[model samples]
Target chain A: MTHVITDACVDEKDASCMEECPVDCIYEGGSRMYIHPGECIDCGLCAEVCPNGAAVALRLLDPAAAAVHGPANDAFFTRVLPGRQAPLGSPGGASRLGPLDVDPS
Target chain B: MTTHHPAPHHPAAHHAAAHHPRAHHPAVVDAEACSAALDRGETLPWTWYADPAITALEQERIFRRSWSYVGRTDQVAQPGQFFTCEVGGVPIVVTRDRSGGLNALVNVCRHRGAQVVREDCGTRKSLQCFYHAWTYGLDGSLRGVPRGDREADFDTSQLGLRRASVDTWGPFVFVHLDPEPAPLTEMLGELPELLAAGGIDLERMRFHHRVYYTIEANWKIAVENYLECYHCPVAHPGLADVLDVSPDAYELEVRPTFATHHGVVRDIPREAGYPVQGPVVEGQYHLVWPSLKVNVNPGQPNLSFGPVHPAGPERTTGYLDYFFGDDVDEAWIKAMLAFDDQVGAEDTDLVESVQRGASSGGVERGRLLLGSEHTISAFQRFVLGRLRED
Candidate 1:
């Protein structure tokens, strides 16, 4: 049910969506931003404000894309990032913590 | 909590969408058999769902003649404020003139038939056709022509935009294509009373949000899905929990021009969808004969209604406009919308599945469990009767 940031945001990390997100579930990757699946409230604000049309509802994604991205999004919060000691794992929100400087790739 | 009636409406006109020449196909639906099947508690032939000839007949007989919901008064509250919509595939524009009167006109330009008033909605003194600049007054009269002086045979006065009947119940506005159609009250039947019973203050309602959607199925299929909730327990589990969709608790009352279903809130409510507000005792849903729907959920003082019209023999399009009280809770509104969206998504899948099966010719007819789905029969009968009249 979380909105997923797709390959459209890979190089263009126009993070205007971060400013509009109420919970700041959007996180910065090296070249993109990933929406923390667990932290997202499914409010759809990120999908509305996304400049490059990167943020999309899980339902709107094609089945092939959804199949891959949904679990990958979960891994971003579960699997440890390159720099972080442990996985992001719902750090409450990303607004105050800023970018974690890593993604699940 | 306060009970209120619908707003008083004044003046009238018609609606718009471009018309295409209906290609006639021969007798497809056997009306007599369909009627007998309904009488015997059987369903109509699946051909009715996929036949272009029958769809054409419905477009002419039912949709064109019926008073269709087009927009709300809030959309055209000020002078020169206008919005365009279609009923029966004919483009229409509704505007408020300087005298504070509403004008409903065929949006098709009198010149080359290019549509005027192209935007979804805006404030403008005069509507002009984008192609030819054929200017029209807010009253839908032809006010200016690009080169009428050059065309010797032109009759500007006689060539003003065509009018259609327009009426309103509270904030809801309806338009008819018939030269002089029956009053919308007749079409509405006891629906206004149903709204009052639900305690929706129609006079105080304002437009909040709209979701325009298209279903890849016949318009009738989509409407039939709405007319009955027998499938709710299996198809719409979330909604089944919120509304007491039990056979005995759900009340379906069918009138000549309309049918309404009232569901008493079950005492076992705990979580999910929207909580019942203090004023709400039940969930009220209504269908005005053909395709217009009025749905008031439990948690909020709101009405979301719209018309479903055919995009093609196998396609349907419509919009649900959500209206709420002044300064209602924003969170409540979002919750209500999300709940509706969840049910709507489920319904889209179901109706589309039905359309797929019906289109395959695998089964001639879809038999119904009359006890739970009588409304579908009533609706199908209404459609067949209307088409038979022609």
Candidate 2:
């Protein structure tokens, strides 16, 4: 199962998870940070170092909430929210597209 | 961002007018009395200690203009070694270049203001922003842009990391925000000679450890507390036991660029765990204006120096770097550090209480009792001198 960023990270976009993620899949967002689902190695390193308990394995979440976060995380990269037309992919950093200004689940 | 406007008739203003007859209300600094008090040897009005406006003024006029101490030279001794610190809220990284030259560069990335060097200390061939892959050479030249080919008009030469003036004296490293600051040697003015005269060997010292404390007091209050030993007998009994607390045993020298206190230690209690056994020794304390303190304890080859940065109007964060010679044993170093921690705890409690008193609005100002507290008065004068320059 892949890892997901929970509600605990909103407004507290602490980058410890980004630093700990071996694949560098954790991407920053407008309000909260996002972890690229396709790129995540499911190593669980992010969950261990998160001071706010924001990072969690998808299997650990309630089935209903996981269903929402799974799509929302995918949509962050795959859907153009405000300024752009296509998914962000791995444009090196989330900051390049600037903040999406959308709340992350 | 929410903006807070003070009430037209703030309670602090009313209190200042009623209780403090000498209060320079609103501005809180009476130019005439501040100047006269220097000669009279009295402390500045207490309002200076608690005013947010005054703290802002000090940030621009004092901290920015002074050569603030950043860290020890040995901290970034090797090429590519670097450490990040701040002066007046501006983040800076000090690195030793390939040619053995020390360079201080603003830590912000040109692309999105992200800090390029996140760690406190590390060795790196280049600094790269984590937000994007924009990279800079260790010498602070913008080396690479992740997608440079796509940006046809982007000029990399003009976007190199901003540099600040950096210098080193003995084991200390200092940085100045002003591009053209007076030579660090000139600013130090006889401090090196004075330390040498006091038997401090700059060559033998090596950095040991750093302890930080966040005090709920204005940065000036912490500094004033350090400038004078007047409260030693009452507040720091532990410190008084090692260093002579008597008025006659202490001598304060107020220089143009710095202030110093030389105190002869009382007889070392054989029971006291002093690593070096010797006759009575002298403790040297020096303060370079704005926010750097250097302390050399008696009976050992030890040095502690650091800066106090203002976190807010009534808050300060300070760190002290402890250094000792190669000859000192680890057990003795630990004992010395413990002793210092005990003394620091005592001072912290005292300064925090003084912050409360200054903010209470009942007390107008403090009087600097002559002879013992001249250094404190001198410090006030220096602060006023800098503030008035603008």
Candidate 3:
């Protein structure tokens, strides 16, 4: 299962998880940071380093609750988000992208 | 572009009244007796460092009430430039308004308690909460609320970001969580004059860099380590080589609001990379109560300002803001920074070990060796006084 960034990170985008992620899969969104589902290696480094306990394993969450984050994270990269049509496949870093202005969870 | 020459050396000026070793430890919570003992050069109980309750008390009584360093005015020099910091776990954002006046606002959004300014620092026309885009003006007035027309009784005029007590002293900006705090200048006492006497130009100093350390020790342990240099001769041989670390040579003056440690530099060794030589340059370390520390080393026109903040009961997060004059060469600055890094590493090792011992339950109280460590005792007394104050 892929790692998901939960609601715990809503306004607290400390991005410590981004620093610990060896693959640099974590990306920044407008309101909250997002973790790319495809790029994550399930290393759990982001979860370990998250100060607010926002990063979690998808398998550990209740299926219904975990459902939103997985797609939301994918939507960030696929750019199926409300305002955009173009795909933003791995832009290397989060600082470059305009914030999606949506809740991260 | 002003330069400062070192003042004349003065020892025996600010020594503690007298040392009086007691056979038995007094009551730990007795503030009056503790003050007297500290006046006579004694330390606080070891348990004070490890107790979680004391940490909470300190946060309420000391950190909340005292003026805390937020950032430099230069950090937010232009209108709409802003930065966020936490004082005793309370998040605050300092911004420069259109009128060039500084404003310190509680960083939490009025909408849903979300942090309005998420990024550490940046230039923003308006602070918009990432949560719902509820926006605030540079002066902390509520500017926008998404879908506000739908609400029947929503009054946008009544809801603005709460302001914290904010002020500036020279280049530094400070905030107080207390609704009404003593003027920052009053709290500073004679620090302005003292710093001037030591040749520190508050207006001309420019930000160089910042380095943060997360230590596995209480915040006080790190602060106490800085308050005294008795550990230097043995624990810090590299530092001792550059600065005179002898107990007789080091001078400490404990004032009502702060403490200062003066160390004259030794004859520069041939191998040492210091750019200036002859007529020894002095090193001054000053601590403004609660959590501010300033260090000015010899042979360099630089100032290191740091604050030790408690992240948890046993964890501390500290960062040093290095400021240097334009004349100081980058190579010499880098070398000085490297030297500071080495000294910091040595200090953290010692402080962490002390933390382990203090938390191990093996010791209840530790002795304060009067001649060299009176400054530490003074610091403990300062903390205890604040903790017990009304």
Candidate 4:
């Protein structure tokens, strides 16, 4: 399963996760780092490097955490977030698109 | 197991060994045509060797994506043993956990990206990064993290070291950046069998010594030099005598992932500054795709293999880890090492000169005398195709 970023990450965007991700699947939104559901290799480096433990796999999350963050994680890319006109499908690497002032509500 | 190398391909017709299309296999290589092509020279422009941008593309497309030899299996024979190396310039640490399992970790910490294992080789209970004291077990599971664990959400399991792909062929250990790369066998083709046919037993090989070489040329230039022996007569007189570097007799076999050359050793005195005649009758020089070189010299059972790594666009560096049968005499090993060194030294001079010419901007490209240098043409094509993949 893909990794889901929860509310625990709201403003605690340590961004340490961005540095360790092998596939560069984690992108920075205005408020949090979003893991691309399609691009995430389930490598778990993002979750491991997250000092706030904001990055968690969908399977490992609590039922409540998964129900909310898992869908929100997908929505962050698939349904476009604030300050964005289009969905941010897999842009390959976070470095390419850089940090965005956008995130799921 | 018997190293299953029954017959090293000493092709009576070097032409029969020509399979790659556009290769120098013209059934009957016209001597006049060969002369004309040599005059024209099918070599790439010097920029490929002198340009930093070309080197960057190679690091990304070739080295980072392909599997190359990093070390020998014996380096991690016992549990807790480990060796650190680089694959395409990325730091890697290969470890054997307490459970006897092997792991190829990123070597970079899950923390701020500092390399965790700094030593070249060692055996330890766990890895502790010097920066902030983040410790990881031999299996790559994070074990400890300084005094900062008081944070409510510091989960050690999720923060273990990142892993790459590791596999072995006989005693040769290969690593790839991809977490789970294709099986090493897929990339090895008939190499192991061919090396065996050249009279080497990886099972009997033991760690002897290693010799590192730094050359002032692109890694591709170093590799291209290895693919053919057309210059062996002029540049490597000693090697020419030892490896039957005749254009007509030198054997070249190209597989999908590797290429093999059969060098029939000339019958002569086994000088201390030269190789002895025994165990190995033919010298099998094999290259595995991107950058691995497997050399089986004629002498007591021996094998020395390693990767040609790109230090930069204008420089290449690599090491040959020598292995010989434990029963072989020490003096014989020394002589073989010396002979190999002499040839390597000569090669260093040639490649450096070639690099100078490439960087000089006086030449455009050289046409190939495909008859004797088809192997190089194939390799150059491989490099060109890879760089153009994007």
Candidate 4's TM-score: 0.69
DockQ per model, Cα: 0.01, 0.03, 0.02, 0.02
What is each model's TM-score for chain A?
Answer: 0.88, 0.81, 0.78, 0.90
Tally clashes: model 3.
Answer: 2
Instruction: Write one digit per residue (lDDT tens) for candidate 2, span B80-182.
Output: 8999998877899999987888999999999999998999998866677777666677788885564454468889898889999998898889999988999
Q: Which tens-of-lDDT digit does each residue in B173-231 have in candidate 4?
A: 88999987788889988777777777777788888877676776777778877887778
Model 1 docking tier (incorrect/acceptable/medium/high): incorrect
* TM-score versus the correct structure, for each prediction: 0.72, 0.72, 0.71, 0.69
Consecutive 10-residue window with the lowest summed lDDT within model 2 chain B: B1-10
Reference-based lDDT, each prediction: 0.77, 0.75, 0.73, 0.74
Query: What are the clashing pairs of model 4?
Result: A30-A102, B5-B197, B40-B367, B41-B366, B41-B367, B41-B368, B42-B366, B42-B367, B42-B368, B43-B366
In candidate 3, how many Å is residue B116 off?
A: 1.2
lDDT, candidate 3, residue B98?
72
Q: Comparing 1 and 3 by DockQ, which wins?
A: 3
Report the error of model 1 at residue A40, Å.
59
Which digits, one per residue and each the tens of the lDDT, describe model 1 over residues B1-390? Answer: 001111111122111111323224544346787799998778777767777877888888899989999988989999879999987878999999878999889999888999877799998656666666566777877755644554688887887789988999888899998769999999998888888888788887778877777777788888888888788778877787787888888888788898778877767884667766546577788888799888888766877888788977877877888888776788888877777777887787777778877776667787888888788889989988888885
Output the lDDT of residue B324, model 1.
Answer: 87
Task: Score residue B163 of candidate 4 by CA lDDT.
Answer: 86
